[model samples]
Target: MSESNTPEQNSQPASATPPKQESLLANLLINIAIPALILAKLSGDDWLGTKWAIVVALAFPLLYGLRDFLQNGKANFFSGLGVVSILLTGGISLMELDAKYIAMKEAAIPALLGIATVVSLRTRWPLVKTFLYNDKVLDTDKIAAKLEDNNNLGAFELTLKQASWMVAASFFLSSVLNYVLAKVILTSPPGSEAFNAELGKMTALSYPVIVVPSMIVLILAMVFLFRRIGKLTGLKLEDIMAAHHR
Candidate 1:
């Protein structure tokens, strides 16, 4: 009877099964569905007045807030600001039927992100670090020891700071380019004309053209900086990416 009881205790029932992996539904919604809806709505003939455009543009940040709430339990300040800026500029364009707001939209998103990046660098919180890498399992003592021994914390902070500045600078330059394109190439007026021409150009170019290149440049620069720093610190790019994915 003891032998029989031991077998019963050791053997588990076959009815239980492992939990299913989480779906990629949210990723789909954000990356594909939302952008599609925004593009479709913007392309439509219906009048997207200033108020409506503002409301719609504001939705981006709100959605991001919702995403943060669901995923991380906190709203991201920088991402929220970027969303708001995009909406503000986009709304302005829609209301006046000008293209300046639309053109500015291209510049606004990156600029806002850049600002957020700078603000985040000032704190010991490592806000961007949290976003790009998962440091949850990191040993505080180890990290503290590393920070103490290495004089490179200042350098690391500067790298992040400069990277953020670069993003803002790039966006500012892009905005200026768009402005010039509107005034000289498209013959757009300062306010409404520029807005309209900018919208037309954005429509033709698409958001990817503007966003992808900027991000690519930013990431590449960051990677190069990371590599240089890592060589000195004995860290690896894979380590950063793994932390980010987690």
Candidate 2:
């Protein structure tokens, strides 16, 4: 008879390894730089022209997002919303809608996010937990244990709510800036080469004008939450932060 296999040999792995994270530099180049360049430089009669340029420029982000979802094998809320936002942008530009509609759309996305962040507080999972206190960034289990031992859970909850508010505020600020920037940079009528180039300029400027300030606010909120966690749990920042983060 054939020899029986050992249990170890028979056992399958519990799960597949997680997908590798994408490079930040590559993400920026594909999502921002490439699209900006295409729209600004190629939206002319000799090249792709205005309408075709919008299609080609938007295609990069659409495909990149799809690739990211396929690699991760899961869809998060923000990623879904991003896909929708890109679709709306392409639709508006292709239809040759007024620039004001584009400005409104720009403001609406962040405004909706801000409202959602605030509303999530009423549910079991607060947005702050996702953004600031998740296992990716913090030793959440250890922090929970410490809070339990010190009977500081109540205080921790309150502090977390405050952080959530700060995050919402940042989203609101982004909404305002997005509208202003779109309105300021996008003046030419849609379907024109001038309009396409202006859209490209707006896309390129968005990082420094809106994204940088929003990131600063988010960083401040994270710092505040971490400090409060330190105080409540009597743990040092390095101790509470995840090993990878540390």
Candidate 3:
């Protein structure tokens, strides 16, 4: 007769490792960055103009800096600066009760982000790429090695260019759209009830209009560019993701 196996041993699968926790940076970008941006922009309106809103909006960067500090015992200096800048700007705007200052806050953030992104692209560091993709997997070194071995220098450069352009475009477009909406709201003639109603609708939709389309466009652009880069360099997405994880 054949030997019988125990239930515990027989039921176990060959590979049984648990999933890894998400990296801190990934959590920050997804859960903190986008929502903070939305809150900072929306908090500009007079009706929603509470001091607490400004505090909450500014807390995202602070929390990110705190996480960095806890993880490495050294916070990103610029990240800390960004938190301070947001708080100072919000405080001054609140004290003055100037709606324009609040409106301009949205414009300022995107510009700062664009500048930072451009600076990062100029370096070999690939800071934003590291922040977004690093620690997502466990094979980052292999991916980097593949990128180097594939020798598609042109494709790599194109990826950087596309990313820089997208960052700048998102900033400028969001700022322009927000400015236009603010102008319409501030300039609507008194007693034009129909215009006021339409303005309300536009204002309500403005955040979604700017954010959703920009994000979709950014995603599509990255997908197309990454695919082209993969074909040119003979590197797969899995390879890149793995490389970054290391």
Tell me the tens digit of each residue's lDDT in model 1 across 158-216: 66566556655555555555444433433443234333333444433434454456566
Tens-place lDDT digits, model 2, residues 105-215: 999999999998899999998888888889877889899999999999999999988999999988999999999999999999899999999999988998899999999
Candidate 2 regions with alpha-carbon error over 4 angstroms: 1-22
Report lDDT (Cα) of residue 179, candidate 2: 99
RMSD of each: 9.7, 6.6, 10.0
Ranked by TM-score, top first? 2, 3, 1
Per-residue lDDT for 1-246 in model 3, tens only? 012245533443222222123454454453345444544454444533344454555455567567767877776765666566556555753464444654576466667766777778778765446433244432445545556788766666766667666756766777777666555553433223332333334434654766676677567656765575567556676654432221
Looking at model 2, residue 150 earns an lDDT score of 99
As for lDDT, the candidate ahead, 1 or 2, is: 2
Reference-based lDDT, residue 46, model 2 = 100
After superposing candidate 1, which stretches have Cα over 4 Å from the reference? Answer: 1-72, 115-144, 150-164, 167-206, 236-246
- Among all windows of 10 consecutive residues in model 1, the one with the lowest summed lDDT is 12-21
Which candidate would rank higher by lDDT, 2 or 3? Answer: 2
**Each prediction's number of clashing residue pairs:** 7, 0, 6
Q: Which candidate gets the maximum TM-score versus the true structure?
A: 2
